[model samples]
Structures are given as C-alpha cells and as structure tokens.
Target: MFILGISALYHDSAAALIKDGEIIAAAQEERFTRKKHDLSVPINAIAYCLKEAGIDVGQLDAVAFYDNPILTMERFLDNLVFAAKTDDTDDLMKFSYDSIFGTKLWIHKELEQALGGLGKLGKLLVAEHHISHAASAFYPSPFEDAAVITMDGVGEWATTTIGYGNKEDLKILRQINYPHSIGLLYSAFTYFCGFKVNSGDYKLMGLAPYGKPVYYDLIKERLINIKPDGSYRLNLEYFDYQYGRAMTNEKFAELFGGERRYPESAITKREMDMAASAQKVVEEVLILTAKTAKEITRSKNLVMAGGVALNCVANGKLLKEKIFDNIWIQPAAGDAGGALGCAFYAYYQYYGKKRVIGISDSQKGSYLGPAFSDEEIVKFLSQNEYPYEKFESAEMFYQKISALLQDEKVIGLCQGRMEYGPRALGNRSILGNPRSESMQSQINLKIKYRESFRPFAPSVLKETVLDYFELDGESPYMLFCANVQEHLRKEFSLDSLLDASNMDMLPVVNQARSEIPAVTHVDYSARIQTVDEERNPEYYRILRQLQKDTGYAVIINTSFNVRGEPIVCTPEDAYRCFMRTGMDVLVLNHMILYKEQQPEFVEWEDWRKSYELD
Candidate 1:
C-alpha cells in the first residue's frame, strides 16, 4: 500500500511518500517556494513526491499528518494559566493565527483539496507531535529495538519524551510538557545571541567554541531548574515566548546585563559566552536524559529525533559519554523528518504492519530527493548556451575534479539526488582544499557571505576516518563532531587572545588549529561526514582520486548555496548560485562550467534582497 506523510504549518515543512513500507521520495517546501523554513502547506513538496513516485495524490492508500491540532490547541490554551493577555494575544491570533490555524485545524479538507478531491482515499490519520518524532527515530534505525528520545520546542503538549521501541511497537514511558522545554530555553539564548530561533540555533552552536561557559551556573540557578533525571522546568517569569513573538522579556535581559543583540549586529564576548553556556547546559541535559533512558528501558541502542537533536555538538558529547552502546540519529531530525516519521507511524502502528529489520537504516543515506541525470543537465546547458565541458567517464570526472581541488579551486557540485536533511553531503556541496589555510575565510566571506566565525565540515573517506578525526563507526549525515587526531593538531597559544579586552574573533577563527586548517574549528573539532562507496559511489570515487593524487582523503564540504538561500534544487538554481558567488567551478552532473567562460549574469533583483538573511 502507498502512504503519504506530511509535516506542515510549522518550520521546515515537508512531504514524504512510501510504497509498501519502502520510502520513495521526500522534499522540503522551502526548496520549491524559495522561502527559508517555509511553514505553509507543503503542496510543492507533495507534488514533487507524487511525480517521483509516478502516481497521483489520490492514489495513496493512506495519509498521515505529523501533529494533532487538537492537542496542540489544548497546550496553547493551557499556557494561558500562567499569563493572560501578556502581549495582546488576541491581536496575535487575529494577525496570523486566523489564517494559519483555520487551515491547519481543517487539514483534512486541505489534504483533500491537494489530492484533487481524494478519490478512494483511506484513513487520514494524525499522530501526536512527539509520537511522530519517536516513530521517526526508532522505526528506520538499524537497531531491532532501541530507547527513543524526542526533544524540541513545544509539540502538542510534549517538549521532551523518553520511549522504548521493539520491532513494530513503541511506547512513551516519560514526558516533560510544554513551557519546560530544553529546546525553548536554548532558542531563547539563540534569540538573545542575535540569531533566528529554529534556523539560527546552529549558528549559536558554532559560536560556542570561541568563548568560555561562564554563564553555565547562572543559567542553571536562575533560568531553568534541572533534575538529576533530566526532567526540567523553565522559570516562566524570565521568558516572553509563552505569550507572544519575543523569546525573552526585560527580566531576562536585565539578568544577562543588557538587552539582546540586534540581528546581524556585532558579536561581542557576551554573546559568545552565552552561546557557550547554553550549549553546555543542553549537552548536560541530553546526556542525563540518555542515561535515564538506558536505566529505564535497559536498551543499549538509542534513537533520537527533534530540532535540538540537530545540535551536533551536544550529540557529540552524548556519544562520547557512551550512555548507549549505539546511537542512530534521524538525519532530518527537525519537523521535516516528522513527515517521514508520521508515515512510518501510520504503516506500522495504525495499520499493524510488521517492520522487517534493515542492515543499516531505511533512510538510504538520505539521498532521496530529486536528481538530475547527465543528459538533462547537458541539455539545459546546451539550450541555455552556457559554456561547459562534458567528462567522458567517472574516472575522468574524478581525476579532473581532484586536480582542480588541489589547485585551490572551489567547486560547487550538483550531482546525484539531493540530501534529505540540512546537510549538503557530497551531492550538493561546495568543495575546497581543506589543507589550505585561507580557504575557510575565502569561502565564508567571498562565497557564502555569512559570518566568518562559522566552521566548515570535512567529507572524509570512511576507511580512513581513524586517520583524521577521533571517531568510530560511521557519520554519513555529518551530524557528529569529533576532535582532530593528536598528531594532526598544532600547538596554539589562545590564552593571550582570550585575555584581550577587545577580542577580535577573526584571528581566533583563522588560527590553524590542525593540518586540515580549513575544516578544523578553534577547538580542533570537525563535523565529519564519513563517505562510503555503497551509498554515494560517485563522491566516494572523487575522494579516492583525491587521496591517490594528494595523499589526503579529505576535502571541505559546505552546502552549495549562498547565505539565506536554500540549497540549490535545480540546475538553474545551481548555475545562478555559481555565477553570483566567487566559486571557481560549477559541476552539474558530467558537465563542468568555469566562471570566466560564462557570460555576465544579471540577478532578478539586487541579489542580496532576494532572500531575507536567516
């Protein structure tokens, strides 16, 4: 039976399709709508999935939604107990809620509308938010049975949940409700640090290594009350998110010493320290929760899915603690992955289908999005009159790209299927020589047009993973950070730099902390993606060719898009990004286009205004 899944009316809205328990296609609405973190109905995403599956929307045997609107409304009304009319909530509802919630609560009608009247439609099921998250975590994991943890901002009435899954059955054993959320607490710090809540939390995580966790004690004592078992309560007096749009109130600002920084403003030591403090608290809470999961469920394997699970630094620390013998994190851990999860819930839980164990995971390396064949790419380039060269073979492609990379050329790769999650992986990535000391600054300022403080990730060959980063097993999704090997790390003096009253982060960011200076962060840690031949053979072959030519099996891999833009979803999107950026080369399937060979391109508008900076 075919099943359609959807996560919508929240951030990272997406759609997933599965046939006979096999996942077929998935895509985010932001890709098609050109809106970062688009939360509308994922109509475009649903259309794409239907096309990829070679079926009409009405062909689906069943449809599942990631969240239950009734429960979510209950939680929203329950929060009124603490603060009523704090920020003119009536105005808030009238402003956007009427349009948003009215459509959302009647999602069945919307689904029917999208399905073109829903011919022979089966059950339209809705799973609770955290239940969807838990199903997403445990169902596709490599483990036969595992303890599941889902932690994010308020979802229905749950913010955090601990559960156990065995075969097709999953049960929630514990829950921490809304208003006492680890995700919201961290998001408050994210806003105070001058970043967007869901979209910019990773930027806050990236900023943590630059400063000390001096506010750790203060945050624990005043902002949140944490129990040894990992359940926590938020000090509601300090936060304003319960009532309105603002994450924090004046009390929170006064406690921190000043008002929250403006977006895209100066990054001071205060912001860095706060990021570090919040990151530390999150790591501690996650580890404590994992320990409790092991104690209660007695399961050695653990699976996780949530927005907070996107914090790779916290994930790395939890992995290091070894609270579970194994951990499998949903790559699309945010609400987007909830689409995939709810589908699994419908097939396995609602329909009582048995889950046949997989050797690794059902996610298929998350390379499940649209892919352009060489013929399609070449046809587009030829028709557009774009100057390009078509490689004769995979070997020729790999050899030439490896040489170009060694010459310090930054290449944007749009090959194979797009990655399902936030990470670029190998298919849709901008690659650079990691050994180059200035590559990070060059890419950040000249290409990405984002903060210089953010670090790049390394896509390393899985066989040689131990040669570089201190990591075991596989990290195919680029979801974990590990320290550089001791031999590769260089001795650096940061004590004097940290002591400076006016600290310039540029110097700290530029410091060569390891042999692969571009990918290494200030703390000498790298978010590593272990590449194997099985999943993405073409990328694996290119790395192998690079290893053969330069003796280094690693290269820098960042998403192939400019700041605030979603990763390129089409060949035209890829070409536009390449033309606008300072990238040296653009690889679209087998065709390669050089910057100097292309004609001068005019953007639709002043390119910077095209996207709101995240």
Candidate 2:
C-alpha cells in the first residue's frame, strides 16, 4: 500500500511517501522553495515525493496529515477565551477567529486543493501532533520496544508527551499541554536574547558554553516551576504568548533587568547569561523527563523526537547519564519529521501492519530526497556553459578531492541524495581541512557569510571516532556533542585563555583547542557526525583517503549554502552558490570545477539580495 504524509501550515512544512511500510522519499518544502523554514503547504515537496515514488496522487492508498486541525482549533479557542478574561480581546480575538474560521476549519478543503482535486486520493488520516512525533521516533528506531518522549512548542493542546512503544503499538501515558511548555519557555529566552524564537533557539544553545548560569535560580523562581518528575507549569504573569503576540511580557523583562535585545545587535554578557541559564534549565528538565520515562516504561531503550530533541548539548548530557541502555533520536525531529511519523503511525497503528525492526534504522541514513543523475548534471552544466571536469572513477574522484582538502581548500561537495533533516551530512555539505587554524573563520566569514561565533561540525570516520572524540557509538545525524579526546587536545597558554571575554570570544575561539581546530568549539566540545562505510561509503572513503594522506580522520563539515539560504537542491543551485562564495572547489558528483577556471560571475547584486536574512 502507498501512503503519503504531510505536515504543513506551520514552519518547516514537509511531505513524505511510504510504500509497503517503507519510507521512500521525504523532503521539507523550504528545500524546493528556497525559503528558510517555509510554512506554506508543501506542494513542491509533495510533487517531489510523488516523482521519487514513481506514482501519481491517484496511486496513494492513504493520505495522513501530521495533526488534527479541529483539535488545534479547539486549543486556539481555549487560549483566546482565556485572553478575553485577562487582556484586551479585540486583536487577539480577530486573529483567532480568522485563523480558525478562515483556515484551520477548512483544512480538509485545503488538503483537497493541495492534492489537486482529491478525487483519486484514498483515505485521509489525521494523527495527534505529539503522537505523530512519538511514532516518528519509535517506528524508525532499531529498538523493538522503547520509552518515547516528544517535546516542542504547542502542538494542538500537547507541548510534551511521554509514552512507550511496543512492537507495532504505542501508548501516550502522560502529557503537558500548551501554555506550560518547556519548548516555549526556552523560546522565550531565545527571543529575549536577540534571536528568532523557533529558528534561533539553536543559536542560544550554541552560546551557552560561554557564560555562567547565574540566572538559573531567577528563572526557576519567576518564570517556571519545574517538578522533580519533569512535569512543570509556567508562571503566566511573566509571559505574554497566551494573550499577546510577544513571547515575554513587561514583567519578564523587568525580572531580567532589561528589554528584549534587538536582533543583529552586539552580544552582551546578559544575553550570554540568559542563554546559559535557559540551557541549564532545559538540560535539567530533559534529564528529569528521561528518568521519568525510564521509571514509568521500564524500557531499556529510549527514542526521542520533536524540536527539543534537536538540542545536541542536552542530547549529549542524556547520553552521558545513560538513563537508558540505548537512545535513538529522529534525524528530522522537528515538525518536518512529523510527516514521516504520521505516515508510519497510519501504517502500523491504523492499518494494523506488523513492525519490522532494523539493525541500524529504517531512515536510509535520512538521505531520502532527490538525487540527480550524472546525465542530468552534465546537461545543466553544458546548457549553462559552466566549465567542469569528470573524474575517471569514484575512487579517483574522492582521492583528488581529499588531496585538495589537505591543501586547506574548501569544497562544496554536492553528491548523492539531499538529506531529509536540517543537518547537511555528507550528501549536501561544504567540507574543509579541520586542522587549519584559519579554516573556521574563513568558512564562516567568506563562504557561509554568517556569525563568526557559530562553530562548525566534524565528520569523522566511524572506526576512528574514539581516536578524535570522546564518543564510542554512532552519531550519523550530527545530533550529539562530544569533547575532543584528551590526548588530541592542545594545551593553551594562561594569557590566551584569560584574554577571552564573555562578550567577544573570537580571539580565544581562534586559538586551537584540539588537533582539529576548525571544528572545535570554544568549550572544546565538537558536534560530531561519525561516518561509517555501510551508511555513507563515499563520504567514508574520502575520510579514509584523508587519513591515509594527513593521518587525521576528521573534516570540517557545514551546510552547502550561504547564511539564510536552503541547502542547494540541484546542479544549477550548487553552481550558483559555488560562484557566489569563496569556496575553492565545487564537486557535483563526479564533476569537479575549480574557482579560477570558471568565468566571472556577473549577477552579484541581484544574487546577494535573493536570500533574506533569517
């Protein structure tokens, strides 16, 4: 049976296709639309999934939406009614009425329209938001039975859920509903710290290691009341999300001794402290939640999904605590992943299909998106009059690229299928030599055109993971941070360390903390992606070749796009990004292009204005 799953109308809208209980294709709408976190119905992504599946909409046996629109509308109504009691209801009521009566109430009609007149479409299924998240975590995981947890901003009424999945069935034992969300609590600080809420939460996470968590007590006392069992309630007086458009109210700013930081402003010690405090609270909640999940389910394994699960620092702490014998996180743990979860939920729970466990996972390394053939790439290159060269074989291609990387030359490596998650992985990555002291600054400033404080990730060979990082298992999705092995770290002078300020740490960040300086963060932790031959043989082979030449098995890896742009989707997109950036090499499958050999790119003004800053 063929099933199509969709998550839309919120950020990271996406579509997924499943055939006979196997995920065939999945992609976020942003990828095709070239809009960061595009929230429109995933029309282009759905088309891509159908094309990848070699089936039309008529071939689908079921269509599963990630959440129940009616339930979501009910929650919105509840919040609006509460707002009426405490605050001015004019604008809030108008927005809520328009949202529910205008759009949410007509989701089925919208789906029919999106599906191009749903005449041939089969059964339409709707799963609860958190249930969809739970299914996405447990179904694709290698565990037969595991404790499951999902946490995010308000999803219908539920913001967090704890459950257990056994074989083909799953059960939600408990939940924390909207207006008392850990996700929203963190996002509040994200907003106050000069970052966009849903998207900039990670930036807050990245900034945490720089400051002391002195405000943790203040947050616990004033903002949220977290319990020992991980259940919590927010002190609504300090937050405005329930009644107003803003996340935090005047009381919140007063408690924090300031107003919200304006976006793109200079970093301050207060922002850093708030970030660190928020991060500490988040980690504490996660750990408590995991412990409760283990206690209730008595499961040896744990599976996690939802946007909060994407916090690598918190995930690393969970791994270190070892509350469960094993843990598996959905690569696309955010709302985009809800598409996959809903589809699988319909397959196993709704259709009564048997679950089939895998040795690793059923996500195919999350490389379940479009891949262009060499012929198609060649046609585009020829049509565009772009200069390039084709390698003799895959072995020779990686060998040459590996040699180029050793020279500290940055390569825009676009090969195989695009990744289904926010992470770039090897399939859609810009790679550089991690050993170079200047590589990090160069890529961030010249190539990516992003904040200098953002750290790069390391893609290390699986066999040599322990040789470089303090991790022993797989991290295929770049979802965990492990310290560089003690032996591999370099000792820094006291003066160099003392000169690093809380507000401006670039001088200290530039100092090599480990053998691989480019990928190492200021705290010496590296967000790790361990590459195994079985999962990604081509990327692994390149790492092996680099190891053979440079005697190090790590490479700096970041998404293959400039700031605010989605990762390149096609050969044309790749070439345009290549010419726009200062990348030294462009590897499109077997074809390679050097920057010096290409003709001058003339559309700088228009191209620079194309992508809006996130």
Candidate 3:
C-alpha cells in the first residue's frame, strides 16, 4: 500500500511518500519553491513525490495530514477566553483570539481546496498535531520501545508532549498546553533580538556563545513557572503571543530593561547576554522534560522531533546526561519532518502494519530528494549554451576538484543524492579549505551573506572522525557534538603554550579536532557528518581523493544555496546560483563547469528568467 503524508499552512511545509512501510520520497516545499519555510500547501513537494514514486495522485491508498483542525480551533477559543479573563487588551496584537485563530483555523478549508477536494482521493486522515509529532518521533526510531518527546511552539493546544512508542503501538502520557511553550519563549527572544520569528531562532542559538547568561534568574523568577514533573506555565502578565502577534510586549521590554534590538544594527553585549540567558533556560527546560519523560515511560531509549529538537546544543546535553542509553533525532525535526511522520503514521497506525523490530526505515539516509542525471544536466547546459567539460571517471572528477579546493577556491558540489534536512552535508554543499581563518569571514560575507559568528559544519570520513573529534559513533545527521582531539591543537595554535597547566582552563582548545577549524564552533565541538563509501559511495570517493591529495580527510561543508534561498533542486537553479555567487567551480554530475569558461551573459532575448535567480 502507498501512503502520502503532508504538513502545511504552518511554517516548514513539506510532503513525504511511503510504500509498504518504507519511505520512498520526501522533501520540503521551500527547496522547490525557493521560499524559505513556505507555509502554503506543498503542491510542488507532493507533485515531486508522486513523480519520484512513478505514480499519480489517484494511485494513493491513503493520505494523512499532520494536525487535526477541530482540536486546534478548540485550543484557540480557550486561549482567547483565558486572554480576555486577564483583561489583556493593551497588548492587542499578540494576546487577541482572532489573530491566533486566523493563522491556524483558517488553513483547513484552504488546504482541502488546494488538495482538489475529496474527489482526488478516497480517504483523508487528519492526525492530531501532537500525535503526528509524537508518531514522527517514535515510529521510525531504531528502538523496540522508546520514550518520545515532541516540543514546538504550539500544535493545536499542546506545546510539549510525552509519550512512548513500542513495536506497533504509541501511548501519549501527558501534555503541556499552549501559552506555556518553550518554543514561544525562545521565539519571543528571537523577535526581541530583531530576527524573524520562526526563521531567526537558530540565529539566537548562534549568538549565545558571545555573551553570558545574566537574565537566567530573572526569566525563571518572572516569566515562566516550572513544576517538579517537567510541566510548566507561563506568567500571562509579563508577555503576549495569543492572537495577531509579535512575541514580546512593553512589559517584556521593561522587564529586560530595554526595547528589542534593531536588525543588522550594532551587536551589543546586551543581545549576546539575552541570547545566552534564553539558551540556558531552553536547555534547562529540555533536560527537565527529558528526565521526566524517562521517569514516566521507563524507556531507556529516546526519540525526539518537532522544532525544539533542532536545538543541537540542548540535544548534546541530553545525550551527555546518560538518562537515556540512546537517542535518535529526526534530521528534519521541524514541521518538514512531519511529512515523513504523517506517512509513517499511515503505515503503522492506519494500515496496522507491524514495524520491523529496531529498524529506522526512512531511507532518508540524509539524502532523499531529487538527483539529476548526467544526461539531464547536459541537456540543460547545452540548451542554454553554457560552457562546460566532462570528466572520464569519478577519479578524474575528484582529482580536478581536489586541486581547486587546495588553492582555497570555493566549489559548489552537486552530486548523487539531495539532502532531506536543513543541512546540506556533502551531496548538496559548497566546499572550502577550512584551515584558513579568513575562510569563515570570506564565506560569510562573500557567499552566505549571513552572520559572521554563525559557524560552518565539516564533512569528515567516518573512519577519520576519531582522529580529529572525540566522538565514538556515527553522526550522520549532524545533530550530536564531539570535542576536538588534544594532540593536533599545537600544530594549529598561533599563541604560545609553555606550560601544561594552562591546558586545564582551556580543555576545548588546541584539540586535533577535525582538521577543519572554520566549521568547528567556539567550544571546539562540531556537528559532524560521517561519510561512508557504502552509503554515498560517489561522494565518499570524492572526499577520499581530496584527503589523499591534501592530507586532510575533511572539508568545510555547507548548504548549496546562499542565505535566504533554499537549497537548489534543479539544474537551472544550481546554474543560476553558481553564476550569481563567487564560487570558483560548479560540479554538476559528470560535467564540470569552470567559472572562467562560461560566457559573460546569455544576453538572449528568449531567456525569460522564470527560474529563481537567487
């Protein structure tokens, strides 16, 4: 049986398709549309999945949506009544009920209309928001039984939920409702810090390292009330986010002793301190929640998804605590992963199929989207009359690219599989030599066009991760953190280290960490992707060749597109990005296109520029 899953109308819209309990295709709508976190119906994504699966929409046995609308509406009305009871009229935008319902309740009929109504499919299943989030977390986990935690801003009414998933069953134990969300708290700070709400939270996480957590006590004492069982309630008086909204209010500004930071303005000690404070609070709440989930379910293994699961720092702490023996996080842990969750939910929940014991069947393998054939790439290039050359073999391709990389040239590598998560990994990545301190600044300003302190990630060979990092297992999803090795620190250190005693205070410094420093964070920890030849053989072979030539088994790996645009999904998109950016080389399938060889411009009248130019 074939099953389709969808998450939309909220941020991070996406789609997933499953056949006989195995994930066949999955992708976020943003990747195809070039709209970052597009919150409309994922028509392009659904069409791509159908195309990938070699079927039409009519062939699907069942379709599942990630959230139930009625339940979500009920929560909206309740929150509105609660807001009025407090007489919160001054903070009209965020605390009003109409604003909240308008964003959530209005999407259902709109979605069905987008889906071509009931005539297109025989049955449509509407899964509860948190249930779908919980199912997405546990069902694909490689554990016979695992405690599941789903945390996001607000899903219908539930902001946080705890449950357990075993072979064929899932049981939700308890929930923390809306107006008391860890996500909203973090997002409030995200907005106050002058960043976009849903999209800017990661920026808040990145800004934490630059400041100290001075507001921790104040936040805990005034904003939220945490209980013993990991349940918490927000103090409605100090904030507003109920209706039409921006997160914080005048009271919040006063509490913080100032107004929100202006975007792209000076990055003061204040913003940094706020980031650190919010991050610390988020970490504490997550740990407390994880510990509570373990106690309630008594499950040794844990699986987590939802937007909160994207907080790698918090996830690292959870892993370090040893409360759970193992943890598996969905790479696309936000609403995008809900598509996969919905598809899997249809398989195990609706069809009553038995899950394979201890199997994570979402062949997602990090690379789950469309990959262009050499012929298709060649056709596009030739039709556009773009200058390019073809290599005889994979060895030749790697040998040439490796030489370009050693000279500190930025190379856009678009090869075999497309990644499913926010990270690009190697398949859809821009590569650079990481040893140069200037590389970070150059890529940030010249290419990424984003923040300076926001660090890059490294793609290390699976066998060589230990030589540079203190990690023991495969970090295929780039979720976990491992410190750098101690031995190699001396080689890269610019300052003098005369005494061994100095090392005591600098535990994370000068570790033989993955030979790539730009990608490594301030703590000498890296979110790593271990490349094994068996999984992505072609990409691994390229890395192996580069390693042989450079004596380093690592390369700076980041998403293929620039800051605001989504990762490139088509040859046209890839070529346009390559032309616009400062990249030195474009490796499209077997064809290699040098920047110098291409024409100054097509300047053709027929060129419509319909493809996303960014």
Candidate models: Cα lDDT each: 0.89, 0.89, 0.78
Residue pairs whose backbone atoms clash in candidate 2: none
Model 2: worst 10 consecutive residues (lDDT sum): 493-502
Q: Tens digits of per-residue lDDT for model 1 on 262-338?
A: 99888988998999999999998999999999999999999999999989899888899988899999999999999
58-130 per-residue lDDT for model 3 (tens digits): 7787778888777866776676576677675455534444434665555545555665542245667878877
Report the lDDT of model 1 for residue 20. Answer: 79
Q: Give the runs in model 3 whose Cα sits over 4 Å from its true position.
A: 86-113, 117-121, 358-361, 490-515, 602-614
Q: Can you give the lDDT of residue 457 in candidate 2?
A: 97
Q: Per-residue error at 416 for model 1, in Å?
A: 0.7
| Candidate no. 2 TM-score | 0.97
Residue-by-residue lDDT tens digits, candidate 2, 1-614 = 88888998777999999988899999999999999999888999999999998888888888888988899888877887888786666666655667667876676778788896542444478899999999999999999999999999989999989999999999899999988999999999999998888988889988887667999999999888999999999999898888747899899999989899999888777887899899999999999999999999999999999999999999998999989989999999999999999999999988899998988889888999999999999999898788898988878887898889988899999999999989999989999999999888899889999877789999999989999899868899999998998887888652346345535656666778788999888778999999998888889999999999889999999999998899888888888899999999999988999999998888837776888766
> Ten consecutive residues with minimal summed lDDT in candidate 3?
503-512
Ranking of candidates on lDDT, top first: 1, 2, 3
